[model samples]
Target: MFSTLNWFGWALLSALFAALTAIFAKLGVAQINSDLATLIRTAIVFVLLCLYVAGTRQWSNPLALSGHSWLFLGLSGLATGASWLCYFRALQLGNAAQVAPIDKFSLVLVVIFAVLFLGERPSLREWCGIALIAGGVMVLAFKEQG
Candidate 1:
């Protein structure tokens, strides 16, 4: 079913879901502890993912995973947890419009990390786009103080 869609299509869907997540999370976090909110969200995600893996019969034994895979995946989970905590706190303390854009500054960092760590070379056009995104994040994240 997904064969016809390319990476860009998937990325667009991700962007749509991410935008919805920000709006929904902002509303949900109101009048609650941000950390508790994040925990609830994480629990929901964990259950859903577990169901998905079970339904798909894609569960792999932990022992089957290589050490490198375990290490990297563990690190990724830690990073995700930290990111979610920070994102939820930011949402609680700020407007979704501002917080989401600042969170998206990750795009710039991803580009740089891809080049340096993954040895993936982006074209000059892509670099320009990255720079533009960074600039836009700065513009969106900062407001003039009266």
Candidate 2:
């Protein structure tokens, strides 16, 4: 099943799950401190991923990985943790509709960071779509609540 799809399929699934996460986390944060809630969420993800890797026989020696891989993956993990913590806190204090779109402002940042740091060159069409995302987020951020 997983073999049939390429990146776009996986990205669509990720977006669906992420939307659910915002809704669920908002409800969960109501019952506990946001920081503690993030910790608990992180723990669940860790254990589930462990089981998934073990069940799939995908485990390998971490020491076998290159220093660059370790460095980048470690930094990515830190970034993910920070993002989750902040996302949970935002859900605790704001409407999911608003917070989720603003959170997606990261999409614009990703495109810019890719150009500057990763030497990526998105086509004009891609730039237009990215601009739309940025504009949509701004609209969501500033729209009057009637």
In candidate 2, the residue pairs with backbone N, CA or C atoms under 3 Å apart (3 or more residues apart, or in different chains) clash, namely none
- lDDT for predicted candidate 2 compared with the true structure: 0.95
lDDT (Cα, tens digit) per residue for candidate 2, span 1-146: 98799999999999999999999999999979999999999999999999999999999999999999999999999999999999999999999998999999999999999999999999999999999999999999776869
- Residue pairs clashing, model 1: none
Q: RMSD per prediction, one decimal?
A: 1.3, 1.2
- 28-54, model 1: which lDDT tens digit per residue? 999899999999999999999999999
Question: TM-score per candidate, in order?
Answer: 0.94, 0.96
- What's the true lDDT of residue 68 in model 2? 100
Error of 2 at 10 (Å): 0.6
**Model 1 CA deviation exceeding 4 Å by range:** 1-3
